[model samples]
Target: MSIISLSSGVQNNLSIMPRWPATQVLIDSLAWQKLQAVQASLPGHLGLILTRAYEPRVSELGRARTAFRRAGICLFGLLYRHRKEEIQDIFGSNGHDLDGTHIDVSFSINGQRVRLLPLSVFTPMSWQARRIKKFDEELSMVLAALLAQGFQLHRNATESLQIHCDLKPVL
Candidate 1:
C-alpha cells in the first residue's frame, strides 16, 4: 500500500497511534512499526511520504533545535532494544509473537527522558536485518527515519564535551 494510504490509516485511528504534542508532530511509534511490518521494502515514493509525514517545517526544526540547545537536551540517534518481554510489556500481546526490535530515541525532552521506537515489527531479529547481508539495508532505513524526523548529523561533535545538541553519526 502507499504511504498516504498508511498515513490515512494511522490518522484515522488515534487510539492506536501515539499522540503528537499540540504544537509539533513527533513521529508515531506504532505507525512506524506498522509501516516496517507491512511494507516489505521502502521505495522512493514511500520514503518521501514518510519524510513528509514527520518532517517539521524547516523553521520549526530550527526553532526546536535551538530550544533544545538552550535546554541542554541532546538528540542522540536511535537505539534498538530487542528484548521480547520488554516489548510485550509495553505494547501488550497482539496475537503476533512481536519479535521485532523497537527503536528507542536515547534523548531527552523538556528535561525529561523518553524512548522513541521508530521501527516496530513482529519478525524475529534473526530473520530481520541483523543478518550480515541485510545489515546495510536496515541501517539505511533507520538513518532515513531519523533524518526524516529532523535529526541532523553532526560530524565534528563525536566528542561528548563538544556537543550541545547533536545526532550521533552512522559511522
Candidate 2:
C-alpha cells in the first residue's frame, strides 16, 4: 500500500512542508519499550492496538532510508541505540514497522535549513485506528519541531510532498 492510502488527514497535513533540514531518527529500544509499557498500563483500545498491532523494534534502517528516498526528501537518520546482530538482521521484515524516527539534533547548512518532505512518508498502512493516531503524533512532533526551529511548513493544495520534493544533501 502507498502512503496516500493510509489516511486522508495525513495527506492534507503533509501536502505542504515547512522549509527545514529534515532529520529522521531511529528511536532507541528503550523508547519503544517505554511506549509499549505506557500502552500496557492503559486500559482500553489504546493499549490494545499498541500491544497487539505494533511491530517489533527494528535495528537496521534500510527500509526507512528507502522510504525517504521514495519520498525524495533529504532526511538525516539518527540512531542512539545499539542492538544485537540478530535484531539488525531482522530489520525491515515487517513493512508495518515503519516510522522509527525521533528527532535528536537540528542543524542548518550554510545558515539555511532545507525543506522537509511531509511527515506522512514515515507512516505505514494499517487498519487499526489507534495505530493511525500514533502516526499522527509522530508527524505532529516533526512539524512542531520544525516550526520551533524557525521553519515554516504550509499545505500545498496543488502538490504533494511525497511526489514532488527532491532531497538535497544537508552538507
The prediction achieving the highest TM-score against the true structure is 1
In candidate 1, what are the lDDT values of residues 37-134, reduced to their tens digit?
Answer: 32334443222112112333355543553454333222221223434233323232221112112122222223232222223233334544343243
Report per-prediction Cα RMSD to one decimal: 16.2, 18.3
Per-residue alpha-carbon lDDT of candidate 2 for residues 46-96, written as tens digits (9 for 90 to 100): 211111111223434444544544344322122212222222222222222
Could you tell me the lDDT of residue 67 within candidate 1? 59
Cα lDDT over the full model 2: 0.28
Sequence-dependent TM-score of model 1: 0.23
Error of model 2, residue 139, in angstroms: 12
Question: How high is the lDDT of residue 145 in model 2?
Answer: 38
lDDT: worst 10-residue window of model 2: 45-54
**Model 1 misplacement above 4 A:** 1-46, 49-85, 88-120, 130-132, 135-145, 148-171
Q: State each candidate's clash count.
A: 3, 2
TM-score of every model versus the real structure = 0.23, 0.22
Model 2 lDDT at residue 82: 27
